[model samples]
Target chain A: MSKKWLSLISMVLAIGMVAVLAVGCGGPAKTDSTEIKIGGDFEITGGVANFGKSTVNGIQLAFKEVNAKGGILGKKIVLVLADNKSEPSEAANAITKLITQDKVVTVLGPVASSNVLAASQIAIDNKIPLLTATATASKVTVGDDGKVKDYIFRACFIDPFQGEVMANFAAKSLKVKTAAIYVDNASDYSKGLAQVFEEKFIKNGGQIVAREAFLAKDTDFKSALTKMKASNPDVIFIPAYYQEVGLIVKQARELGMNTPMIGTDGWDSPKVVEIAGAAALNNTFFSNHYSPEDKDPHVTSFVEAYKKEYGQVPDALAALGYDAALMLIDAIKRANSAEPAKIKDALAQTKNLQVSTGILTLDASHNPVKSAVVIELKDGKQTFKEKINP
Target chain B: MDSSSFLMQFAQQLINGVSLGSIYALIALGYTMVYGTIKLINFAHGDVYMVGAYIGFFATTVLGLGFLPALLLAMVGAGILGMFIERAAYRPLRNAPKIAVLITAIGVSLFLEYGSMLLVTPQPRTFPAVLSSTPIHIGGLIINSQQVLILGVSLFLMVVLTYVVNYTKLGKAMRAVSFDTDTARLMGIDVDKVISYTFAVGSALAAAAGVLVGVYYNSIDPLMGIMPGLKAFVAAVLGGIGVIPGAMLGGVLMGVIEALVSGFISSTFRDAAAFGILIIILLFKPAGLLGKNIREKV
Candidate 1:
């Protein structure tokens, strides 16, 4: 009888311990707040951690600056951060947790377009205002109606504009009459950019000698590069992320296909240099949000501050994240409330706001009509080339 | 496509397929050999390949070793890692159920993959150029010198392995142990030492394949080995598990078939074609290509 009583006590203790552990693991619950809360759902750990880390740094810097000037509407802005680990499913879960548990008035994040697509449905269902910083896919905001999304906004310019800019530059600036495109068929970003570039280049009276497709994770490009070389194109346009782009560049060089290469915003990564040696990367061009060489006082100040804090110049994603946060703060101050509906309304009216990238004006599709700068790699340094206006 | 261009492309694709097949054969031998001796599928074998690639990467890029020295170091490093894995993970469970060892192998694989990702950055790194950069042309076919080197090395290793398994004293001991561990032990063979040696050989071959593939492809990532490892496993099973020559045959056949499917049919069905062949083969030949049927004792 005493042994049975002891067993029962132990069982009760085990159950209590499990319950406490469960509660501890669960995220903090939403509480009545005099604090204006904003949640960031980002990939802090995963293949794309560097991109996520840069955006988080930008967001934190903006938050610190805003809070220092007396929090939005005299209420201290509380930032809640969650790591999504660069997985689409995790991004969805993080957004749901941010909305339901944190009760954040607004959300900023999810750098990848795939992750943004996964999380956007939750934002739409919950009627929460989500402003993405780095996702450039046009379909993220525009639906079948081609109109601005009511609750969704993106700080980056759409792919179609960037793609056309690249194609035009390749033809007129690089003077390439024949081009080849190596696209990652598995990625919507790669496919969309390739389609746009192909169409615009063909329209400009340039010939597309070969169009090759590869899996995103494909490491072998010899066969593809061989085929591309046989076609004898003047330039190769690879519309993929830096991971593949770097290797492709290196392999293409090794194969003696020394023609200049072009890419999109995905080329803005330090890994590119590590993979494609600085010497091999010469003459490559890419379109980005903003270059560090921009002489605008606002741009110079942000560059200086970023270098001071991080000991490195911020990439386009970082600038966009900083701009997105400032935009959110402006909306909140204009609305004079932390209510989601009011902030959504204020964001829709955002215009003529000068940002680190350029003057921000949301188009009908809720994408920022920002200027894109074309950067060229010369002697291992990114030089300011020309700016294209959307 | 024109006719000559089509023929040229087809020939080029065939060469590419064979080059890839050679790498697959190297890895498949490791899988088949381990399965032949011990019934456990060493899922961690792929990570062993990944470790080899990293070793080569560090040796070449960080330590700045020449090509031949870096490769030798990578093989030795991988052999040591393989022996360590056998001692730590598989040794304790020699008498356990096959499923237990299999699960443990998978656990070890995951541990290595995630551990590598956490320790090293998750991004893919470019492998240093270690092979010749020129391509050789023969009649309508063009092949890179690196591809030729890969094929030559793979064939040489396969031949060496076949000889070892057939003639050497260690080989005889391994065969005896695989046939019946209890009888082999009663005969005074050191089962533990033979098993460890099998892992070392298997892992060394996988390491060579890993570094070769990395250099040939010019990119290496943490999860790079998962798909190739799965395909190589299928190749091992298709060729008749336990048969060294059979694994090489199966690997080359699988590679050529995949390339043909991608070249003639659709690139999208490349993976499906490889696995579909395996399923069909399994349905007809349950014991595999060169597999022997063993009657169980009542």
Candidate 2:
């Protein structure tokens, strides 16, 4: 009797889990015949909440457009969104809620790759197709054995390509002979990009002069920056998020080591210029999913419509979110069924899908084989420099 | 590269370490003071520092105050908030179980963190450059004005604290109250007033550290208080809980050791190295470096 609370809580948890599993095992819960449900588990309120919010907005925009032109496959697209609060555990919980409680046919988002990796298994086990908008981690779709997971897919290019694109650009275009790397070893995204870039740069005949590491919480970079200055690398690669990347760029610039810096999509936030100051942002570039400066009509009109809807131009995250939802809808239409398996197969064969970023085509690994854009910063403005095709 | 270059690098790291160490010392002082006075961990003290930084942030960015003035405003704001927290939250749980009071302190901490997050989103704000941070090079050694300012302001605050705790009449009363609260009250000393003064002084020091960090790092956020707060507590314990100089020594040592580890070894194990040293120090000197063994009267 004294252990009643413990037993009761556990029993409730067990029952809830069973109920979820039952729903997963059963075929789709019959809702309105004219409605097809899709779930969104977004990181809408934590460190990467910006990505989540943008993703949700992007999905909403695509859904609204589809609804206006007669819903996909003769069914109204019902998006059931859940905020994961930018936590991994919450992302998993959101997916479970969607599959069991909402009975969604497929899911989208939980943008950051870490969250994607965390929530991927549940969707895999429960047989729900989960499509990520911008998660670039190679391991997100491809298993540790280097095989593609059946149900998990990403709307963006993988990390190797992103790192390769930047390294190639720096070597072949910018003609930088040497580079320094400052990475956040605590973050998988940063570490992944750093390792890939280092490998590819050396392959491209560029020498790594100095390599230093820091944590996400570390505010001081002078020690690392000072050492990097001694080597005098032609370029510095800080493949970290805006929080640390902005500071690194500013400090590096202030230290008079204004070697042109390159970063990944993590640096594609307005906070970068704000933290680093506009003057310090000069001569810095980053590889991203979409460049608003792209003259592509899809990108231009998406920016305009996104501005009208959200009161701001969509960032790389927003563009990817819209693209992911658009493709998912396209898959549903191509499959011509409400079944999850058919949709997954259709998603595998998606080709020449015109989205905001570029023409998206899903490779065998479930990652889009799309071109990546390198945007140059001028007075803190993102200018389209060149697009690297796969 | 060369010996002189190595020496220059060593000196530069030493400066960076000491500059960083001073802020830890400042934040650690608050923890030491609160624990010394009430035997409470005062988990919310770091949040008071966060409050101070935000105060300084608004003062500089919104009110258009200069660096010194903004710092003063931050100190005043945080000092008052510290007193208010002690009166409202901690005071209510004072007569409760020790665990209750400790839990309340943690609650206060989370409330401050999440409340601030709600008020000013979770986005990290760029702290305005109250002082120019352009590195001033000397020989091969590099020093920035912000580093100099951190070292200078921290030393000034520590010195002022040492003076206040050692010489002022309020200092005598605070010491008396901290030694034996019941006895101090029985002897006609204002116990409540002394504790309030202790919280104010301690909070002001933490606030100063907050502003200093905002300037040094050029970034501040609501959740910023958590890590530094825990680290300061560690510094307080490593120095010898309830001892002023012990906290200072512990903080400086921790900062120096961390700087050296990250600079020479690997920054990935920076936190592990810090906690690892703390474990070693505790194993050797259980009462901290400057902590003295006091016989239990009971």
Candidate 3:
């Protein structure tokens, strides 16, 4: 009798474990005709939470604005968000879940290029449209062989354009003779921008005085900064993320090497000032998208509304997220169907799509042909300098 | 690039190394003291340092204390926490096997890291400027004010620690217990109290190091302690695990070497250089730099 009871309990336990497993991975897809589903998997936690949070905020705002005006094709939009927890593997899982379980018509986000590269594979495999607004690496849309992937699309100009914009600004606008390059050696994004900046700066008849490399988590750049000081370049180009940029800037000033600094859009976050302090923010410029200081009606209205809603000025991440959402919703409307393939075709033929960033037009490579803005930092406030046209 | 500048850069790197090593030395003191008294590695010692930084962060940000006061409070709070951990985790495992106690230490380490992450979230916080960061220049040598604080505080703590270990009654009791726990118990000395005091002293020192590091680096996260903790342990081992002065010596040397490698060579080889020192040291001196060999009869 005891042996039979033990067998019965084991059988029940096995079934219960399987049921629990099913609940986690097998969130069944539900199809609804009345509302279109849009999925977003963004890093809401972990190291880069600041970036992801802003992106999610922007996406949420766009969806709210669209819904208030009646969502595409007279059907309400059901926005689904999954937190990637700032990890690539988690991003992969979130994207897969959004596609297979949530059955989102077209997915948007996983903001970093590395993450987009990881999460977009599932969308490509399943033939669903995946769009990114901020992932600047050309590889986000283009394959290893230089062919554009059909399903992958980006609203931001590729890394080459960002590097070229900043290099041009340095040469023509600021008119610096020589520059130094310090890049985050671990990031492909940083390396790509650094490479393009080096090439373009030299092409514009400027010389690179010195080049140094450091990893992402490194706190001490004094030795590298000292080397750069020896070269005595007029401007220092740091194509790195905000977390490292603030420290680098602070350390650079402390080391008595007060070369004017230029960085990429990765320096767009407000936390850079918090990290670097206000004193170090002086005499710095960065290339970015859609400055909130723009006088354009669409830009001002969106910025004002976002400020009213979020209680803070929207950063570049927010602008990108809003644009991606707006464009995706527009594609769904243009397609006039909730079908994934129809939406993909519409996105591929995107033209004159007015986004929060600017008037965006996708080339065959899926990168937007939009202008990049150079912003100068003064007293921790971003002052719009001039826009560089592609 | 040139000869004179190279020499200046070398000197600057040395200064940087000394500042960095002092922070390591501060944490290593706790390891040596705890190991000396209890004969346990106390792997959670690093997390105690991490917790100390968070406490300092709150003290400055929430309570609005000055730098020195926040440092003191953090040290005291961590001391209490270290004793609490001892009574809770280590005390129960006293009579257990040595391996069991070691595993428990590892378990406690994980618990503190993950628990802190869950409570505080795994986001990196900018440590507020406890001290100003104006560079103090002397003959092309740029010294950050925070680095000066680290060197000063570590020196003060080390001197006080030396006095306590050499002159205090509690220090005598600690040495007695370290020499022989069973005999110290028979001699009417409270072994448990001495052990707890050792933990308090060590943990307090580690806490002080944590606050100094946060001020120096301007960033702190839950998992930040893991690498530094392992590095401190290696430093402790290098200087002779239970030897107080040895840990300090080991820490300073490690820092100098790390700075040299990163400054003269590539920053890519910085971590590799640290572990490489450990391998070479272990090969030549298994008992450590200051450790003496004693044969045991079977």
Name the docking class for model 3. Answer: acceptable
Models ranked on TM-score = 3, 2, 1
- Summarize candidate 1's per-residue lDDT along A174-232 as a digit string, tens digits: 88899999888888888999999999999988999888877887766655675676678
Tens-digit lDDT string for candidate 2 (A1-390): 859989999999999999997866564556777889999999878888867888899999999989999998777997888778888999999899888878888999888888888899999998889999888778899999988899998898987787888898899889999999898888887888888899999999999998899888667786677666766789998888999988888777766677899988888788898888888999998898878889888889999989998899787888989999989999998999979898999999999999888888998888898889999989989899888887
- Please give the TM-score for the first chain of candidate 1: 0.82
Best by TM-score: 3
Candidate 3 lDDT tens digits, B93-203:
899998999999999999999999999888778888878877887877888887888899999999999999989999999999987899999999999999999999999
Ranking by lDDT: 3, 2, 1
Task: Extract clashing residue pairs from model 3.
Answer: none
Q: How far is candidate 2 from the true structure (C-alpha RMSD, Å)?
A: 6.9
Q: DockQ for model 1?
A: 0.21
Show where candidate 1 strays beyond 4 Å: A1-130, A137-148, A175-179, A205-210, A228-234, A294-311, A325-346, A349-354, B1-4, B61-65, B87-101, B128-145, B178-187, B263-265, B283-298
Chain B TM-scores per candidate, in order, are 0.96, 0.96, 0.96
lDDT of 3 by residue, A1-390 (tens): 999999999999999999997875566455677788888888888877888889888988988888899876888887788888888899899999888888888888888888999988888999999998789877899999988898999877887788999999999988999999998999988999999999999999999988888888676677667667767899999999988998899888887777789999889877788888888889999998879897778888889989999999898889988988888888888888889999999898889988876788889888889888899999898898887877
Off by over 4 Å in 2: A1-153, A296-312, A321-346, A351-356, B1-4, B89-103, B179-187
TM-score of 1: 0.78
